[model samples]
Target: MENEIAIHNEIDLQSKIYTIRGMKVMLDFDLAEIYGYSVKAFNQQVKNNIEKFDEDFRFQLSSYEVLELSRSKILTSIQVKGVKGGRAYLPYAFTEQGIYMLMTVLKGDLATRQSKILIRLFKGMKDFIIEREHLISYDEVAKLAIQTSQNTKDIAVIDQKVSALATIIEDFTSPEMKKDFLFLNGRSVEADIAYQEIYSQAKETIFVIDNYIGLKTLVLLKSVPENVKITIFSDNLKKGLHQKEFDDFLKEYPNVTVSLKRTNGIFHDRYIQLFGISEQFTALIVSNSVQLEILLNL
Candidate 1:
């Protein structure tokens, strides 16, 4: 039974290797967590060093791709916020070589330790693969038995494989950890969701901006508590651009201050930053001419 258990464990691990289809992928944010860098900073590094990473090792997520991920229910706690426009480049997924390159680039005490541990773990997996291949001939009889018996032994073997696969997955991916960061994608809607999260945590200091504001946005902005200090800066536009009713609603919130900076170029990119108790959360929104294109595209 002990030897059977050991062989089952090895088989389960091997099955996953095949199941993965030889494509090693790690989310950019997850890799960032390992390297002790914020996801934003980590992505910036990748953007800066595009030559080091090929399409096989790294690729940005498209808006549609991100939307697909949102449907998976994996993003329960974190909302995917958009960049300046409604579209967002998805988080890059890295291959094995990319992970190795990342460790080299992000070298430090913690990174060194994580790299060493990961390398050793991968080595162990490789060894397990080699050992399993050598034992393939011995398993032929067991395999034949499994095929011949549609009985209890076969069911037990199947169950063992399934459970072992589960264990290997748990070990390999390092699940069951708290998520440190999340992403939000879309236009101003993304900003609204991300800030609401900060508000849920009872944040006080918040900064917001939107060159094109309307009744819907004004309603969203009104949700902020009066005690909270909010400074909103936006591009100066012709009076009555949004509508008289929308502008009139602004008078109701004295604590929430809005400033319009005059600029010929039109302050198009919208962003909101919230300095909570300890951490900072920002959501980028696109307004002005870009917003028109987004609506047209939609």
Candidate 2:
């Protein structure tokens, strides 16, 4: 039974390995599944021992990187979910060394045996690639075949980018104009445009109210003029954005300020209030739904 389980695990590990950023990596979701743990639990362990995992050992995937992997045929077999449910944060990827280091952190007999099997599987894959490289060097036809395979992969990447570009163009060229009330279904191109427009229009004061705000929200405020005074009102100062990360964001935009005030169970909605140079106030009430509704005072 132990032998059978090891064989199954080897096959499963092989399937989960992916090439991202010129390195082979296994996503946190798949790694958690192999270790017999929930995604949240697995990530929590990593967070607890963050000092063990360096930039080379593990790295979080960006939104664009995640989108690219989603569109790839090679990665289609992997279950990559969007920022829904309990997966609001981005996924992390672990390299071969990182996987080995993870075993040291994970406890129990099952983790020990599984770690040995995974290390063997990783070594086998490396040997196989090395052998293939040697074979390709001796045979011209083999080299050509490898080159053609890479070209096909490159074409697929290009096709995916073109499709994304077409979608953005369609959103921009659409005849529908901005309305006082807008319903945004997730993070669409139109929603991004609206966010930018709101930030750009803030001439004097820009006030934001949200329970949780991350690096993505900070990026939207980058377009605010230097003279504009930006203020953030939140229950927690470092809920989504860490202290160090928030400090860096402040360095980039020195005009911004943050204030924390606990509602004691009253505030629950997200809002953005902009004050123009002429003291004209405009407010945007954002609904906390999968399809976010933006009530704008134009």
Candidate 3:
């Protein structure tokens, strides 16, 4: 019973990251499903074991949040069981620690397995986010494009550099690479088709250094094979509010690591090291400042 609940929670955790109202915490629903009791029964367990859930461990949604969730259709459609208030049917949420405590309160073989899987899932998410934060800051990219536009001796030189960069990006999407990857041109619409072709041949890993990563980017990263890794080199400038969530996620993945270093005096060199080993790699560098490389099969 506990194992079933934990598995259900794992699936739930993947979607309800931001903790809007309406999403049921795993243990609540899982226990209810197993014990033939209401979510209130699960809540009673938590109430009985308050020590298990600290401020860092758990929290409830605000009335305003609950209302917003109701408006947005983000809350669960499941009817409330033991809840006595108007919000009983609304979804509730829990943190990693909260879930852990809930398991201790429940006390069963299933509870133990559920707790382990939950911790692992949370850790994995943390690792992913931390790795993502290491990507290039948006300001750095803008500064570089501006710097090149201002300093280049002739428009042709700037054009040539952009062309070369475009070509290199295009080659990444070749047909030969398609079997291994499903690349999408993130930086430019024009690069989309070509980038797809190059990515098909990719193996072992995929690296991307871009300014921004939203939901679409996250989905793509998750699509890669487990054996393959991805690394990004970029500047860490902004303290976006959502940044913390991602930072927490990167703590989960052991294979992925992030490093923040200088690129050029002005613009950070946003590059990737894909399918590379430590000693043997290939990279392109235009200026003495922005050096890019791939270490093949390290």
- Model number with the top TM-score: 2
Cα error, candidate 3, residue 119 (Å) = 1.2
TM-scores, all models, native as reference: 0.33, 0.42, 0.36
Could you give candidate 2's per-residue lDDT for residues 74-143 as a string of tens digits? 7764444464443676789999889999999988767777788898998998888888875645468888
Clashes of 3: 34
Residue 213 in model 3: shift from native, Å? 69
Model 3 agreement with the true structure over 188-235: per-residue lDDT tens digits = 223233333333334676665544433333334443445665554334
lDDT of model number 1? 0.55
> Which residue runs does candidate 1 get wrong by more than 4 Å?
1-22, 62-87, 133-298
Worst 10 residues of 3 by lDDT: 283-292
- lDDT, candidates in the order shown: 0.55, 0.73, 0.51
Which candidate number maximizes lDDT? 2
Better of 1 and 2 by lDDT: 2
What stretches of model 2 exceed 4 Å from their correct place? 1-7, 77-86, 137-298
